[model samples]
Target chain A: MIVAVIALGLLAGASGLLLGFAAIRFKVEGDPMVEQIDAVLPQTQCGQCGYAGCRPYAEAIAAGEADINRCPPGGQNGIAALAELLGRDPKPLDPESGIEKPKMAAVIDEQSCIGCTLCIQACPVDAIVGAAKHMHTVIARECTGCELCLAPCPVDCIHMIPFAPSITTWKWTYPAVEVKAAA
Target chain B: MSALFPFHGGLKTVRHKTESNQTPIQAGILPPRLTVPLRQHIGAIAKPLVQPGDRVLKGQMIGQPDGYISAAIHAPTSGVVSAVDQQPVPHPSGLSDLCVTIESDGEDRWIDREPVDYHRLHPSELRQTIRNAGVVGLGGAGFPSAVKLNLAGRSEPLATLMLNGAECEPWITCDDRLMRERAAEIVAGLQIMAHLLGPAEVLIGIEDDKPEAIAAMTAACAGTSYEVRPVPTRYPSGSVKQLVKLLTGRETPVDGLPVDVGVQCFNVATAYTVYRAIHCGEPVISRVVTVTGQVHRPGNLEVLIGTPFAELIKQCGGYRDGVERLIMGGPMMGFALHSDEAPVTKAANCLLAAGPAELAAELPVLPCIRCGACMDVCPANLLPQQLYWHARAKEFDQARDCHLFSCIECGCCSHVCPSHIPLVQYYRYAKNEIWAQEKEKQRAEQARQRHQARMERLEREKQEREAKLRQKAPVRTEVVPHLDPLISVPSPTKGEGSGQVG
Candidate 1:
């Protein structure tokens, strides 16, 4: 009886030591869930999710503080991706945030731009370029179509123009879904 | 004759060759106006070199090649630029592209010609000259031929330099006429390519249907190492992959090129243009286009680039009665144009004005009854039904796994489908969707990087500001000692502050 107890004790201690060593050896630096959730985000950085940015919102979600549907820029597809990643039920986007819309690129009316740099300061991605009191323009290719610049423009010159399919960007549409009638 | 290798699932499609090939290729009439799209070839659109109202000479460089894969654009004839603005071009999307419109001067003047000796020049220099001359594949896709001539970076030595003379698409006889009329010139171009690529052997594959072209090419290739082999007349046997298989028994790896298998392919018409570029000091300003289908004179015309399709039709005695949709290519892979006002591009092989009799009747698409007809006719030997099912369900990954990219969009499956299902359209949709998703992912990654960079910048600025404040705090502390006496005097006034608070 004594011999069996000592063997069991030694095995338990050795297993505990191994687990402790493994914990230190494979220590994760940060919350990987936050990074994963952030990766699934569209990264528009419009901050419709009530956080400062996509990362902050992702952190909140990882911490079970913020809901996944607060991002309207990500739209329904983004929400579905987030739900799949987080192992949560997919839900409709929160309407209070904003309505989902087509992809848009902000166009600065160059003639009317006041050159105040307010819109430049408001842009999160630094897609806008201009000096103080100069004509500011938005880089259409770099612009994430975030409307954050529109509100900050004192002159109301920034226009959110929806992108139209050009020859280069045009894509073939899916064929019509067939509905068969009963024979 | 070399040993012929047959490919799987090719239809014995109707040969509409005689209508256009009977007559000799005639020089196309110059229209009053020309509309040249900047993006005639694949890759980046050529940058416009001339502004509006600039007078350009024939063979003058009007559009400079923008990037490595792009081709230069030259003026077909001396003319004054009307506008460099958005205009309609012959694309399946029916969208407007930036085009340079010119009002023809009617002089048909030529610019100063500087024909280079291809034999004396290095291969790279020769390729540069060809690229500057705007030589591209005249068969369907206008891929820059100079880009294809490059053999650098390939580990294997080029074995066969195959020239595609198989005008396999029905109703298109441009290649046939070019081979028949300009066989020596085509042979000369092949020699130049062979010199550059240093291939072990040169093989020219002509569809056996065109006896005249075969005989002409054969006679021209006499006393030379070039061999002209006639491939069996099969629909899509002219396709680069199928032709490669038929002639060389080599299978181009999926999502790879012919060059990957030690073979290089070029269209015969492209070779003729290459010869012209070197021999005649001319650029690719014109191509032989077949204007058939419900036209009075259904023949081949050497149409200038930017000539309106309407002008070609008018030159051919206008459209016949009961003319149907105007297609930009052959009946199989061509798309209906929204307007004939769209100018002829280098890729315009034929302008098929298919009538009701020529077109398949508008039948309602029925559900697939598990018919294997599409699979049987697929040239790539892929399971068309499985691809269709996955594509229809938007399961793009599954479609990709079924080698969707290998599909050449030859429309063989669509032609044989019993249910009249547009199978090619589904593959195109799936391919396009995949491309769009890839672009979206790239954009997302870019946005994420920018956002992260901005955050880091803001944090660094905050740290710098805090450090500066810390540096200035010592001065403020030193000055605070002088204000100690004033602070002691304010201690008596604290009673007044407390009474006010109460």
Candidate 2:
């Protein structure tokens, strides 16, 4: 009985040592939970979530310093997803962030652009490209419609426009009644 | 007759064929204005060739095929282009799209035409000619026929080429009339298909209800090796997969084409158009559209592609009293059109001017009782209740797991539901949402990649700036003796240096 007990004890001790070594050998620098939270974020970098960017907001959420309902662009669906991930009850979006709206992109009026580069500096995602004293243009697909660059634009050239639905983007609307009527 | 295979589920709904088919097919009167939407087929919308005030002859190309999967668009009659702008199209969305409006000159003038010997041309060239001719599936799906014909390029040897003539939808006799009146032309087209695909057998499946159509087609196919097989009259038997199953016992793999199973199918009307294109050197400028339901003179009309639906209704002696809705296509899978101002496109098969009695009264929808009635009538063998449940809950992934794409939107499930749930609509909603979600996900992924790339680019620039500063420090020290001490001072440590530099 004593020999079997000793063997079990040694096995446990060896496994513990191996685990400790592994932990030190492959230590990850950042909190993996924060990365996961950031992944769930809409990544708009809108800063309406009471944080500087999506990653910072995710870090705050991971640390329990911020609420999950802070993101307006992610809206209710985002909260639900985060809640499911964290095993928390889903909550309604906090109204201070803003209401959900269709995706919009910043369009710069080339004629009105004064080449101040203020809008370029304001973009967090580096979606704007220009040199000082040169006209700036937004890389439309890259722009997250965060509206961060709007306030900095002196010329008011940048306009947030909703995407127009084309034939490729068109979807069928739900039918009302449930009866077969010959057309 | 060959032994027929039974499909999973179908409805024996009232066949209202006689309401319109009692009279022969009529030639549609030319409307004053024709507003043709460039996107008639399923692929890329045709690019406009004519501007406002430009004169075009009948059958002249107005919209050229943009891509390999696109079909060409032609003017229905000799006309002067009035406008090329957004107009109401015959779509369920009721949204306006780019349309080419033309004012007909009433002359119906023809452009210079030359018939091409399809046999003399190369196979690729022939397919291109057909694509240029704007031939597409006339059986509602409107898939470009040229793409469908290029099955020979696949590794799988072609086995069966089935021609669908089963006008199973009620009150739509366009295909029926086409078969009865122009069976020989359809056979000629079928011969061309046979030569292109070189299948082992050519089978034509027709519903047993139309004996005259069957006899006419049978007579037309007597000399050739093609066989006209009449299947049982069941609703939705005309659907591609169902018709394929009824004719041949082969089951098409889920999310796979009929060509995957060594079989390809085409509608009888598509074949007739192919014949016209090859023999008469014509593009698809017109088609036989059935104008039935609550009209003084209900019959099939050979309508032009760009003719307005309002004009076609007028040709049918106008609307009767108490017309509740105007539907496009058959009742089983048709959509309610908001306006008669919409123009007829290539996909239009039937237009129903339905009255209140004909349409099901707006009844209050009850919750599903789980009666399994919808399950029994699903031709695709999908559990509609489960799809409806998941779809209603917006759990699209779960619906997808249940093979949601297999549901052909046949409306059989909706027809059999005691709950009066628009099950097909729910499925459609779910599908569209899933598609939209997928597109959003793709866009998000692209944005993430771009963000990462920008971050990398910034990091690289910062490193290059630091390296340039380190290299220039010694040079500056040598040039100025008094400032040598400040310039030659050793750089700060790596961590502090980057922070100080910024």
Best by DockQ: 1
Which residue pairs collide, candidate 1? none
C-alpha lDDT (0 to 100) for residue B56 of candidate 1: 94
lDDT of 2 by residue, B83-107 (tens): 9999989888788888899999999
lDDT of 1 by residue, B1-502 (tens): 6799999989999988999899999999989899998889998899999999999999999999998999999998998999999999999999999989889999989999888899899899999999999998889789999999998888888999999999898999999999999999999999889989999999999999999999999999999989999999999999999999999999999989999998999999999999999988999999999999999999999988999999999999999999879998999999999999999999999999999977988667888888798888899999999999999988898999999999999999989887888899999999999998889989988998988877676665555556556555666757776654443211121222121110
In candidate 2, how many Å is residue A75 off? 1.0
Cα lDDT for residue B414, candidate 1: 86
lDDT per residue, candidate 1, A105-136, as tens digits? 99999999989988877888889888787799
Candidate 1 has a TM-score of 0.94
User: Model 2 residue B186 lDDT?
Assistant: 99
Number of the top candidate by TM-score?
1
Candidate 1 chain A weakest lDDT stretch, 10 residues: A174-183
- List model 2 lDDT by residue over A82-103, tens digit each: 9999999999999988888888
Candidate 2, which CAPRI tier? acceptable
Q: Where does model 1 exceed 4 Å of error? A: A1-18, A177-179, B476-502
